[model samples]
Target: MLIGEVARHSGVSTRMLRHYDALGLVRPTGRTAGGYREYSADDVRRIFHVESLRSLGLSLQQIGRALEDPAFTPSALVGDLIRWTEDRLAREQELLERLRAIDASAPGDWQDVLRTVELMRELDSTSAARRQQAVLARPEGESVPAELLAGAVLAESDPHVAGALRWALARSGGDGVAALAAGLRSEDAGIRRRAVLAIAEMPEAPGAVAVLGDALGDPDPTVRGHAALALGRQGVAAAVPTLVGMVVEGSHDVDAAEVLGTLSQDPERADRITTALAGELAAPTADSATRIRLIQALVELAGTSGPEILRRLAHDDDRVVALVASALLRVLEERSRTNRADEDS
Candidate 1:
């Protein structure tokens, strides 16, 4: 087989085969009668071997050493190839994501595309302050795409930067709700927590309420707590149980109680809220602290049954619970009298 025949049969270009010969990677075994490079069967097999190794990302020099050096081991070189391939793949994936985000922004021109790319770079900066400024410094009329903001919001670990990102997302009028909603289903609890926090601030965002409602069942208590508090403020009665549990468990109990108090303004919800608090106080597991917190929450309720519940607790065996209940009972009574007088007037 002459060089031309080898190039045709083995698919290696003649120029490349000559280069391979010069490099001593695949020398032909003999010369043809016409003085063209002659490749025997072994040379053709060697050419195939060289092509196969090249497919695995081997450098020409490395392939030369691999074929020529008896002591050259493949394990370390193969491992290196794997790492290089992984790094390339990761870079490609990041570029793909960046392009997708930019496309999602729906830029009007190349300038808009450049600006969006710049903002994305800033959002990915090592300095949290720079990331925050990137979000805060966005021009008033220039809209940063909600998809970009949502992606930043989910990945940001800095509390301050995260807050700015959420604000920008909210300003996008909930366009990012679907993206943030995707974060809610993340297997990473931290991501779910961040998603709920961002969604919590966008109460008026389309689908924000429904996303928060779904987050109420999140496995993370922190996630559930944030969702419940946000929902409670929106007058969703489903948050009542979680709010009451917050008061009992002492997790954001003050905010939970305040939201519970606001939710209690609905007369029907007021009954349920009062009943739930009373139930917690009456439970066998109710300790002094839990009972006191429950009692404090009870005072925030706006129903006739509040004072009655407090009165029942005032005679309880726990002195602290009894004292706190007794004091709040007078306050409730005073509030009741004031209401009655104002109504009469």
Candidate 2:
């Protein structure tokens, strides 16, 4: 076939076929009397092969080696192509997310778009201080979309930056709750922990209570602890068990104790909280430190059984438990005496 016929038959443009010939990628086998280039059947097939490789994202140079080099194997080249394609896809995905964030901001003009873009870059900056400043630097009356803050809060690892992001998210008036809720479902425990922490600060946010209730069952103890504390402060009794567990385990036991004390303001829950602490103290697995922590927690409880439980612990077989419980019992009695005196006076 002549060049035009080859172009027509193979769907390869004449100019491209000529360029391929110039690169020695696919040369014509013969020439007519007029000296026009002519392609044999095999040459046409090579053109098709080059096109096939190009479809797989192979560069022209790579395709040349693939077609001409006898030692070239598809394994290594295909693996490299896969990696390159994946990298491109990841970049594209990041760009799409950036665009979505910008659109969600609802910029009013080019200046707004530029400002939003700059803020996003700062949020993604390697400097934690810059990231935190980005969250706090939004000018008064310029509202950032809560979704943006939610995404930042979920990914921020720096404690200060994370706190700033969470603060900004809370100011969004619960608009970020949906995004934070999605973070709760992430396979990454770190992300889930951040999500719950951010959500924990927004108790008044719509659906915040429900999301926190769900997080009570999270496998990550930190996540559960934060959720439980948040719920306990909101007067939700469901958090009593986790709060008690936190005290028993000595994980944020002091804060856990305080929240438990607050929850115990209810007469009914006071009994249950007292019993749970007593049960932990009596468990065979309870160690000296565990018993000490439980005793301290009991001191925070208002139920009548709390002192009696401590009284029994005061004479326990463990000398340290006996000493610690005896000391706490005195403090409790003293505290009671002070309250009674103040009321009487």
Candidate 3:
């Protein structure tokens, strides 16, 4: 086949075929009397081979080496090509994500588009300060889409930036609760914790509350603790058990105790909270430290009710528990006496 015919037969263009010939990659076998280039079957086969290698992202130089060099290994070259392709794919995916975020912002003009892009870039900045500023930099009356904030808050690891993001999401009035809810169900523990924290900051919406309630049973104690604390503040009675557990485990026990005290404002809930703490104290499985923490939590419960548990614990086996309980019991007794005196006066 002649050059034109070869171009027609294979998708390779005539100019490229000639360029290949000039590089000695694929030379035609013969020429006609007019001295035009002519291709034999073998030459056409080599052209097809070069095109095939090019489709695999091989450069012309590499294709020449691959086709002519006996020592050239396909394994190493293919591995490099695979890596290059993966890098390109990763870049494309990142760009796609950025575009999606920008589109989600619903920018009204090119300037708005640029601002949203800039905001997103800063939100992902390595500096926590910059990420925080990005969130606070939103122009008045310009609403950030909740979806973007939800993703940022879930992935944020820096405490300051995460706090700013949570505040921003809360101010958004639970618009992103659905996205945050998905984070609650994420397999990543860090993500689940972030999700619950962000949700806790959100305004009380039925959807957000439901997600928070479901998180009460999360296997991660930190997640469960955060959920329990949020639910306790929302007056959800289901959080009582987890709050009591937090007190016994001494994880955020002070905050847990405070919320438990709030929950105990209800007479029925107070009895239940008191009963739960006393039960944990009596558990044979509870160690000395756990019992001590539980006793401290009891004191933070419904007013004078703690003294009864304290009096009982004062005679406990653990000397530290006995001493701490005895001291707290005395304080409660003095407060009771003072209150009675004031009432009589």
Please report the candidate that would top TM-score against the real structure.
1
Give TM per candidate: 0.88, 0.87, 0.78
Query: Each prediction's Cα lDDT score?
Result: 0.90, 0.92, 0.88
Judge candidate 3 against the unseen true structure and give its global Cα lDDT, from 0 to 1.
0.88
Q: Assess the local accuracy of residue 129 in candidate 2 as a C-alpha lDDT between 0 and 100.
A: 88
What is the lDDT for 178 in model 1? 92
Candidate 1 Cα outliers beyond 4 Å, as residue runs:
2-10
Q: List model 3 lDDT by residue over 28-89, tens digit each.
A: 99999999999999998998898899899999999989888899889998999999999999
Best by lDDT: 2
Per-residue CA lDDT of model 2 for 232-319, tens digit only, reads 9999999999999998888999999999999999999999998898889989998999999989998988768899988888899999
Better of 1 and 3 by TM-score: 1
Model 1 — TM-score against the truth?
Answer: 0.88
C-alpha lDDT of residue 277 in model 1: 90
| Candidate 1 residue-wise lDDT at 313 | 83
Local lDDT at 112 for model 3: 84
Give me the overall lDDT of model 2: 0.92
